[model samples]
Target chain A: MSLPLIKRERIFAAVLIIPCILFITVFAFYPIGYSFYLSLHRIILSLPEIGQPFVGLENYRALLHDKVAMHSLINTFLFVFISTFFELLFGLVIALVINRQFKGRGFVRAAVLIPWAIPTVVSSQMWRFIFNDKYGLFNFILFGTDVSSYKAWLAEPVFAFLAIIITDVWKTSCFAALLILAGLQTIPDELYEAARIDGASAWQQFRKITLPLLKPALLVALLFRTMDAFRVFDLVFVMTQGGPADSTNVLQFYGYKKIFTEGLMGYGSTISVLVFLISFAVAMLYIRFIGTKLFKETA
Target chain B: MNRLAFYIVTTLVIFFSLLPFLWFVDTSLKTEIEVTAIPPVLLPSGTLHFYRSSIENYNLLHYVKNSIIVAGSVTVITISISIFTGYAVARLRLKYKGLIMGALLMVSMFPQISIAGPVWRILQSLGWLNSYQGLILPYVTLTLPLGVWIMASFFKELPSELEDSAKIDGCSHTQTLFKIMVPLAAPGVFTAAILVFIYAWNEFFFALLIMTQQEFQTLPVGIALFQGQYTLPWGEIAAASTVATIPLVLLVLLFQRRIVRGLSAGAIKG
Candidate 1:
C-alpha cells in the first residue's frame, strides 16, 4: 500500500523534519558529545596559568574516589526513590478521592493544583521561611523545649534533608495527583458497578478493577515523576544550598557546585555525564518494562 | 461507614493542601512584629502594612513585567513553530514520523542540567547573556518539543475532511493549514499555549544561571533573591511570594476545567 510513493514520500518526509533533526543534533547531541570531550581534559578556571590538559580517564578515576560525588549519587538515588514513592502513593489516594462523584469536587480539584502551579524556587523559599529556626512557622508549630530545640532547618544536615523532602513532596505531589487523576478517570465506572454486583467489597473492587485499569497511567506518571525527581536541583538549591554539610547535595547540585563554585569544569562534566547515563538507563528500563507491557496489553 | 470515612479523609486532605497557602496569606497580612511574636499570630491584628510595604519597596511590577515578556514571547514563538511543524507531521503522512515523534519525546525528557553548561557558553558567545532573548530562546527549546508533540497528537485526532475541502478549493498547503486547520485546532493550541506559558513563567534554573542582573530576573528568580536579601523578613517574603503566585492562581482558577481536560488528553496520548 505504501510502496508507490516510498521514494518521494521519504524525501519529502526528510525535508519536513530537517529543521528538527538539525536542532536535536546541535542542541542535544552536540552538548552530550562535547560534555564527554570536556570531561577528557582537566580545565580549572581559577588557575588560568595551568590551562587545559588531557587527563585521559583520570577524571573518571578521581570521581570514583571522590567522597562528595559518591555521597551525592547515593543521595540522588535516595531522593528519587523516596520522593517518587510518596508522590505516587499520595497522588493515587488523592486521585481516587477526587475521581469520585461528590459535592465541591471541582473546587477541590482546582485547589489541589495550587501547590503544583507555584514555581519551585518560590515554593522552596516559602518553605524555607516556614522551616526557619526562630520566627518560622515550623518552629512555632512544634513549639517546645531544649532537645527538640529550634534548630535552623537548613543549617542542620538531617533537618535540612527532611525539610527538602517535605517541601518537595508538598510542591510536586499535586502534579502526581493530577496525572493519576487523569488515569483514574479512564477506568469506566461500569467496571466498578459490575464488581459490586458480584458482591465484591469496595477495596476488592478497587484492587481488581481500578488497579488493573490504572496500571498504564500509573506507570506513565511514575516514569515522568521519577525522571523529574532524579534531576531535582532548583528546589534543593534554593532552600538549602545542599546545606550544613552537603547532606542534601544531589547529583545536579553537586555538578553545578563543581562547575560554578569550584570552577572544576571537567569534573562537573563527568558528573553530568553520570547523571545522564543514570537517567537514560532508567528511561530505557521504563520503556522496556512498562511501555512494552502497556502497549501490548492495550493492543 | 464508607461515606463517613470519605468525608473525614477529604477534609483532612483539603486542610493539608491548603494550610501552606493559608499560612502564607496570613503571614502576608501581618506586621513583621506580629509575624514573629512568641506564639506566632495565626491571624493578623488587622494590618496590611507588610503587603503595602512589599509592593512599594520590592518593585513587584517590574518582575511581573519581565516574567510576562519572557513567558509571553516564549509562548508565541513556541505556538507558531509547533503549529506548522505539528500540522505537517500529523497530516502530511510524512515518512519517519515515528522517529521524529520519538526524538521529540526524548528531547522533552532530556535533563536541562546536562545542557546548562553548553547553553551558557552558546548564549555567551551570541552575547545573549543577561538578555530576554537568551531566556526566550532556551525557553523555546524547553517548550517546543512538548508543544509539537501535544499539538501533533491533537492535529492527528482532528478529522481531515475540512482540510481536504479547503484544498479542493485551490488553497495552498500553508493557507489550508493557517486558514482552515488552525481554526479547527484552536482549543488545542490554546491549551498548548497555557502549558507553555506556565512552564516558561515558572522556570528558575536557566533564568538564574543566564540572567544575572537584578533587573533582568523573572518572578521566580526575583523572589528567591528577595528571600536571600531579606532572610529575616518573613512577612515581607510571604507578601512577595503571595504576590508572585496570584496571577498563575487566578489563571488556573479561570481555566480549571479546560486545563484539566487538556492535561488528561495530552497525557493520554503523549
Candidate 2:
C-alpha cells in the first residue's frame, strides 16, 4: 500500500535535486575536468597560443623535479600538520575552560572570536607591522632595549614561517574552540553527574566519558582545519609574497606564481591538480573515517 | 585553590588573545614621535593626532563603503541561490544525488589560487577586471559550495511531512519552498549568511589580482596597499586596521551564539 506513495515521493525528490545537479556540473565538475585537460597541453598566453602541444603527462614529470613545487609541497604539509595540531590543542583547552560555569564566560567566549572575525588580510597586515624591525611593537615588547634593531620579521625564513603560523593559529584557534564547545554542550550533565557519583575525578571523567563522546566533533574539527590549512594562501601572500626569499611559499601560492608570474599555464595547472589531489585524498580519508559515521547517524 | 588557578589561566589566555588588538589600538593612538620614541610608550599620552590624521588623509570611509557593498552583495546572492539549490538537494530525491553532493563538496576543496590565473584571464577578456561584478561573481562561486552544503544540512533536518502537508493544501513546490521551508530554515539561512559575509569580506586574492585600481579596491586590498606604501606608518596602519575590523568584531560579539552555532552546525553536520 505504501509502495506507490514512496515511489512518488522519490520521484518528487529527484525533481527537487535537478537544479543543484545542473549547477554543480557546470561550475564545479566542469572546471575541475577542464583544469586537468589544460594540464595535459602546453598553453601560452603571450603569443595567443592555446593547447600548442599535447604534452602527455610531461607537465607532471616536470613538476616532480621542480624545486619550488617540491619545497612548497613540504611547507604546505608542515603548515597543515603543525597548525592543525596546535589549533586543536588550544581549542580543546579554551573550550573546556569556557564550558565550565564561570563569571564573564560569555564575554571571554565572545572576545576570543575577535581574532577569528577580523579579515585574514587585515590581521596579516596588522601582524606584519607588529613584526617590523623598526619601531615595531613586537620587538619593543620582547627585547625592551632597541626597537630599531629588530629582525625583518617577514624577511628571514624561520621567523617568516613562524610569523605566518602564529597569525593562522591566532585566527583559527577560536573557530576550533567554538566547534569543540558546541560538542561539549551536547553531552548531558547527568553523564558527568553519574561519573561523579562513582567517585571519578575531573580528569578521570573527562578522559573516560567526555573524550570518547567528543570524538565525532573533534574529528570533524580536525578535518575542517586540516583541509583549510593545506589550502592557505591569502595570509601568506599578503604577509610575505612568499618572500623575503620564498620561505613562506605554500603549494597554493606556488601554483599561482607558476601560472600568473611565470606564464607557464600548463605547469601551474599541474601544480593545482596536485593540490586538488592532496586535498581530495585528505577529504576522502576524513569521510571514510569520520564523515561516514556522522552521515549514518543523521540519516 | 581551583578557582584561583582557573582564573589565572583564563586571564592569561584572554590577554594573549587580545594583546595584538590592544597593541593595534595603542599604536593607532600614538604620535609619530611616541611611536618611535627610544623607549616605547605602552600607554598613549592622550594624543588623538594619528587617528585624526589618518581619517583626514586616507579615505577610510570610502574603503569601508566599498567593503560593505561587495561583502553585502555577495552574501545576499550566495544565500539566495543556495536556498533554492540546497532545498533541492536536501529534499528532492533526484537521480545521482550522491554524485551531485560529492561533486559539490569536491569543488569546495579546490584551492582558489589554482584557478586564479585562468579566472583572471577570463575576467580580463570579459572586461570584468576592476569591476564590482567581476569580484562579486567569483566570490559568490567560491562561497556557494559551502553555502549549499550548510543550507542542505539545514533543509535535511526539516521533516518532509510539513512540505507534503503544504503541498496537499494545493501549494505548488515553489510555493511550499517559499512559504513553508524558508520560514522553517531561517536560522540556518542566517548562519549561512554570516559565514558567507565573513568569507567575502576577508577575501584577498581575487581582489588583489583583479581590482588594480585603488578607488575600486575592497578593504583588504586597500589595507595591503596601505601597508606597502607606508612602510613606517604603523600608527596609521593600526588605525585603519582598527577601523576596518570594528564592524566584524561588533557582528561577532553581537551574534556570538549564532556564529558559534553556525560554525558548529556546518562542521558537525556537513
Candidate 3:
C-alpha cells in the first residue's frame, strides 16, 4: 500500500510536468531544431524561382566571407566586451554606494530601476531623441549654441556606435547594480566589521572579504549582461537601424534584416546560427566556470 | 563629509537613472513649437498638446488595449504552467533534475532571432498571423523558464513538514497545494506574474514580428511605427511612451523588493 502511494505521487509529478514540457517543446525546442534544418538548405522565401535546395555548409561558408556578417559579428563582440566591462565597473560602484545604510536609500534603489523598467523600444527611442543632432538634449548640453554646429551623433559610425553604447550603459547599468547589490547583501557584515577591528582599511576590507565572497554574483551579472548584450537588437533597430553603412549593426539585427527585410531565409538562418554559436560560446564559458567551482566545492 | 559623499553618489545614481525619462516627459508636455524650438525648451510649456492630440487623433488607447489583452493572457497562461511545473520540480523525487534545469537554461539562451524563421513558419501554418494567440504563445515560451525558476526556488524554501501535516489532515495533494502551498508561495506567484506581465508588455521584437495588423499591434510596435514620411512627432511619441511606462514604473516602485528578489533568484541561481 505504501509503495503504491509513493508510485501514485510519482505519477502525479510526471503528469504535472507534461504540460510544461509540451509547451516548451512545441514553441522552444521545435523551433531551434527547425531553424537548424532551415539553415542547411538554400531556402529563399522571397524567390520561389530559386526553389529550395540542399546547400549544406554553403551558407556557413558564405557567412565567413560575407563582409556585413563578419563586420556585424566583430561589432557584436566588441560591443559586448566593452559595454559589459564598463557596466560591471559602473554597477560595482553603484552597488557599493547603495549597499550602505542611508536616508532615501529605498527611493534611490527604486528610482534606479526606472531606466531598466522602461521598455527597450521606448528607451532606445528616447535616446534617439536625446541624441538628435539639431535640437537634442546631448547637443544642447554639449554645444549650447544658437547656430547649427552640433555633430550628427547617429549619422556617423563612431558617434553612432558611441551613442548606442551610452544608451545601453544607461539602460543596463541599473540591472548590473541590482544584481551586484544582491551579491553585496549576501556578504556578511560581520566580516567587514572583523576586518575593521583588525585595522584593515576600507579598501583592504573590500579586497579581502567582499571581493572573494562576491565572485559568484559578479560572475552571474557579467554572464547575464554579456549574453544579452551580444544579442542586442531592439535598441539598434529603433535607434539607428544599424545605420551609417552598417557600422552599428550587431549580429541579431543583421539576422533580422536578412530574414525579415531581405527575405533570405537560409542566409538569415546562417546569421542566426552565428548568433547562436556566439551565445553558446558564452554559455560554455559560464558552464566551465560552474563546473570547476562545483568540482572544487564538492571535492 | 563621508555621509556627504554617500549622499552625493546616491543622488548621482538616481539622477542618471531617472533623467532620460524625465527629459522625455518634459518634451511630452511642450507644444510642437517648443519641442522643435532651438535652445530646446528646458521646462514644460504648460500645455497638454501632444497628450491630447495623440489620444484624440491617434488610437493610443487601442494599442494599450491590445497590449493589455495579449500581456494579460500571457501572464495567466505562463504563471499557471510555471506553478505546476515548478511545484513538480521542487517536491517530486524526480531523476534528471540537473538535466531539466540545464535544458531550460540552454533553451533560454537560444537567440530569439534563431527561432524567428521557424516560429514564423509555425504561426503561418497555424494561420495565427497577426492574431493575439500568435504573440502570446511565443511570449509564454520565452518567459516560462524564468517563471519556473523563480517559483521553484520559493517552493524549495518552504518546510516540507508543512506539506506532511497538510497530508495527514486529509488534504489531497492538489488540495494541499491550493490550500497551503499556493498561499505561502503567493509572493513568488505575484513576483512571477508581475515579471511575466512586464516582459509580455514591453517585448518589441516578437510583437513587431508577429502583430502586423494595426488593431493587434501592441504599444511598443505601434509607437515604433508612428512616424510620418518626413517627420517624427517626437512629442506625441514621448507622450505615449511616458503614459505606457508610468504604470510599470509605479509597479516597480511599489514592489521593488519582490522584483529584485524574484529576478536575482532566477538569475543568480541559474
- Top candidate (DockQ): 3
Give the distance in Å from residue B5's predicted Cα in candidate 3 to where it truly belongs: 2.3
- The C-alpha lDDT values of all candidates are 0.79, 0.80, 0.85
lDDT of 3 by residue, B97-172 (tens): 6666766777777778978888998998999989999999999988888888888888988999999999898788
Evaluated on CA atoms against the true complex, candidate 2 attains a DockQ of: 0.47
**Compared with the true structure, what per-residue lDDT tens digits does model 3 show for residues A228-278?**
897788889988899899989998899988998888888799887777777
Tens digits of per-residue lDDT for model 1, B1-270: 767777776787778777887788788888768877765667787677877776677777778889999999999988887876777687776655666666666777777767777777778888999999989888887777778866776787888788778867977666777888889899889988888898999998889888888788898887777743644567767887888788789878878776766665545532
Model 2's number of clashes is 5
i-RMS for every candidate: 3.5, 2.8, 3.1
TM-score of each: 0.92, 0.91, 0.96
Q: Which candidate has the top score in TM-score?
A: 3
**Candidate 1's error at A158, in angstroms?**
2.0
**Residue-by-residue lDDT tens digits, candidate 2, A1-299:** 35665576666666655555555554455667767877898886555545468899999999899888898898899899999999999999888877788777778877888888888877887788778776667787778886546666778899899999998998899889889988888888999999899999999999999899898889989988998898788788778988767788999888877777777877788987888888888889988887455444223
Q: Rank the candidates by lDDT, best first.
A: 3, 2, 1
